[model samples]
Target: MRSRPVLVYDGDCAFCSSCVAFVERRIRPRCDTTPWQFADLAALGVVQQRAAYEVLWVTPDGRVRGGAQAVARLLLNAGGVWAVPGALLTLPPLRWIAHGLYRLVADHRDRMPGGTPACALPAARPPGPPGGS
Candidate 1:
């Protein structure tokens, strides 16, 4: 597999930028190489008209991961202290716990740096039944 991994982030996010920087500095040191691909959701097919999004990482195999799972997957690839925690977090009971923690962060990201309350929430569906027009 190619060593260089790709991380997709919100181009307009300051917190996301900081996280990218941390990945470039701290995370990169542990892994092979992370070639970050900053993308506007509109261009990446994650249209803002659909859902409020977070970070995504593309693995060498082209599998995509989002939120804390992405972070853990990246760390696991790095294969160090970062990997240890991620690996540990993936264990049976811990996996459930880890996903819970991830959900908390995803749910309240609006309060975090670079997160906008307006955009943090997913798009609401128009009121209607399951049937199409």
Candidate 2:
């Protein structure tokens, strides 16, 4: 019976925290922001691995959106002028582009302003051979 959505992010990442601060001060989206480390992932319907991988937007109705889509949801919740770009980000070609851009930024977050080595996500492991090799 939660009323507002929850925005889950990496608290260990200074860059991510700074971005959240900016959103709170400027965009002011209608959601509760919590770092994944401090949030109850199971209750939010988010897995720990996925929460570690990207930002998440969990709605009151239990719909979960991640990464760029999460950003779009934030903007949409903010309403007013921000809603225009938010709606566009959910559309076709723009959605494709936004996904790519989000990945790029996520992959290099450690290099972004206010970021530290802690902001770097663990390197993705390649698929292993059969039999746990």
Candidate 3:
């Protein structure tokens, strides 16, 4: 088990790095932040493909949240005025919107400010039916 929660991001993506830096400087969530490439993913209960696809929030007890959910967790952990929006993000309707927006941004991160060609993610695979391959 980890002593602290960890926020895992892609180090090679300049846009992702910049976003993490902003969170550290502005949001100041009470957690350790690390690039997935440098983190012990197995210990964090994160898989490589998921880490490659989205930012992750790993709890001390080993629960892992990814993508927009990770962002919501970060905000909720920060507490204070930020908590409202964070909590809202976890709710329905808004949750769906947040997920959609997150996917949009992630899919085009290479075009985002501070992004480099390295920020371009690999094409994502379509989801299979539940309990089926």
Candidate 4:
């Protein structure tokens, strides 16, 4: 049997906590779900920079999948009805669209319900001259 993966999320983000709660009450995947603040990220081989950017799904094999891909992995792991949509989101065109949408939501999470300014993405680099020179 495949070992349960760990779902790492931002403990400081209210929006993230709300979503995590929803997953707990509804989806209930056979995995360990936790806030990044409490997890030993270094031991898990999860870089803080990446964790700051997106939710991470650390598989038993220690492979990390983040953002939309992580969500898909979680859904699939939930099995039953979730498996279909999860599988679909990972396929071809849908995968591309899903990723883009995930970034959009993640970048604007601060404006979402239960979210705060702290949930916003780090300030983006200002545009500069061609080739940054």
| Clash number for each model | 0, 0, 0, 0
**Residue 46 error for model 4, in Å?**
0.8
**Residue-wise lDDT of candidate 2 within 1-133, one digit each (tens)?**
7899999999999999999999999999999999999999999988877888899999999999999999999999999999999999999999999999998888789999999999999864222344556
How many Å off is the CA of 77 in candidate 3? 0.3
Considering every candidate listed, which one attains the maximal TM-score?
3
Residue 43: error of model 3 in Å?
0.8
Candidate 4, backbone clash total: 0
Check candidate 4 and list the clashing pairs. none
TM-score of each: 0.64, 0.92, 0.93, 0.88
88: Cα error in model 4, Å: 0.6
Candidate 3: stretches off by over 4 Å: 126-132
Tens-place lDDT per residue, model 1, 1-133, is 5455556665445555666787778777333322233344433344332223545666556566666667777778777677898787767787778777766766666678767754354632332334736
- TM-score, candidate number 2: 0.92
Residues 1-133, candidate 4: write the lDDT tens digits. Answer: 2377999998888898899999989998889988888988987778776787789999988998888899999999999999898899899899999988988877788889999988876753222344666
Candidate 3 local lDDT, 1-133, one digit each (tens): 5687899999999999999999999999999999999989888888777888899999999898888999999999999998899999999999999999999999899999998999998865433345648
lDDT of 4: 0.85
Per-candidate Cα lDDT values, in order, are 0.58, 0.92, 0.91, 0.85
Off by over 4 Å in 4: 124-133
How many backbone clashes are present in model 2? 0
